[model samples]
Target: MTADERMAAARASGPPAPGERPSIAPAGRLGSLLVSSGQTAVGADGRLIAEGRVGAEIDLAEARRCAWQCTLNVLDAVRADVGGLERIASTVRLTVYVAGVPEFTDQHLVADAATECLLRVLGPEVGRHARAAIGVAALPTGSPVEVEAVFELA
Candidate 1:
């Protein structure tokens, strides 16, 4: 499948639910840069996809799936902001937050799933980017994983 098709299939459930405050901010552009608001593992219908701490309640595999969903949400935000994915020159960076126990040291491993998802849909060129994976005690909406990204505008 093409990138667009892959993205659509991955997001088969639909885009993230809109909030009183939109996830794709109105002012999403700054010169050649485009920013996406952080997205959690919320389903298209506004339900949390993965809840609780990763190590405590959810396993690594579940956390990884949640991370993939979060990145797909970010892509949807970018698509909304830019009018098309073609406008994205490249992914600049990604920040992934995983709620987990203090002993959890595999946040980076969870983040790899997100990166792989991006690469699968957007190709290596656009998907390659710097990333940070952080383990936190909690996250908004009790989501196990959240992802936010920056892209360079074409």
Candidate 2:
């Protein structure tokens, strides 16, 4: 089903069934956590299609998963929020931040996870943007990764 359709169905079913949601990681800073809710936009089913969050605590493997999922979540939101994905004129930029220990400096690797995901989804269009992957002491919600993008809308 289309993302919108999937969202609608989810909404019809009401909040996720037990265990359907990814557990919230411990809040590190800013008091209560501020997650993306994974849903960038409401699909036709009236369900918000949240694919991932800004900061989550997970193993490196889970961090990688979160990177991919977060990018997809943004892409899905972009499509749903801006009318449709086809309307995307150009990908102007993507900025990814990874929270890690002082010893962990492979920020580029984590950033690529999201970059590659966007490339697979946006095709050559992904080539037209600037990207940065930086390591930070912490993210808003102890989220392992946070991704932001600037797309030229058609």
Candidate 3:
């Protein structure tokens, strides 16, 4: 599918699911760079697509889905704040935080979904980035994963 189609499919359109949603502010620009706030897998109804620790409460596939959803949120937030996706010159960095049990060690695998989604949407020229995938004890609202991004403006 085309990038726009992919984006539309990810969004699935309409309002968020009815659940707890963080108060998110738009990404801010510092010089020619745009830095985004944290985004989770919260669906259109404002509820996390899946809640709990990754290794204990959810499987790898489910955690991957959450990471993908978080990526979409980051892209949308950047698009919203910068007027258009084309305004993005390049993806400078992506930081993925995965909440999981103490024994979990597949945080990088979970982050791969976000990386793939970003490449699909923005293409490699603009999407390739420096990244970190960190496993954490807990995350706000019990989300499985959260993502933040830094982008260079055109």
Best by TM-score: 3
Q: Which order, best to worst by TM-score? A: 3, 1, 2
**For residues 1-154, what per-residue lDDT tens digits would candidate 2 score against the true structure?**
9999999998888786665766643211122212222222233455433323323334466566657766776776666555666766667777777777777767787778888887888887643568888777766434677777767655
Alpha-carbon local distance difference test for all models: 0.89, 0.62, 0.94
Which residue pairs in model 2 clash with each other? 8-45, 8-46, 38-50, 38-51, 39-49, 39-50, 55-143, 56-143, 56-144
**lDDT preference between candidates 1 and 3, better one:** 3
What tens-digit string does per-residue lDDT give for candidate 3 at 1-154?
A: 9999978987886565789475768687899999999998999889889999988889999999999999999999998898899999999999999999999999999999999999999999999999999999999889999999999999
Taking all chains together, each candidate's TM-score versus the true structure is 0.83, 0.60, 0.84
Q: Residue-wise lDDT of candidate 1 within 1-154, one digit each (tens)?
A: 8999988896886655676544337326789998888889988898988799988999999999999999999898888877988888999999999999999999999999999988998899999999999999999989999899889999
* Positional deviation of residue 119's Cα in model 2 after best superposition, in angstroms: 0.6
- Global Cα lDDT for candidate 2: 0.62
Question: What's the CA RMSD for each of the models?
Answer: 12.2, 13.0, 12.1
Candidate 1 vs 3: which has more TM-score: 3
Model 2 lDDT, residue 137, Cα: 76
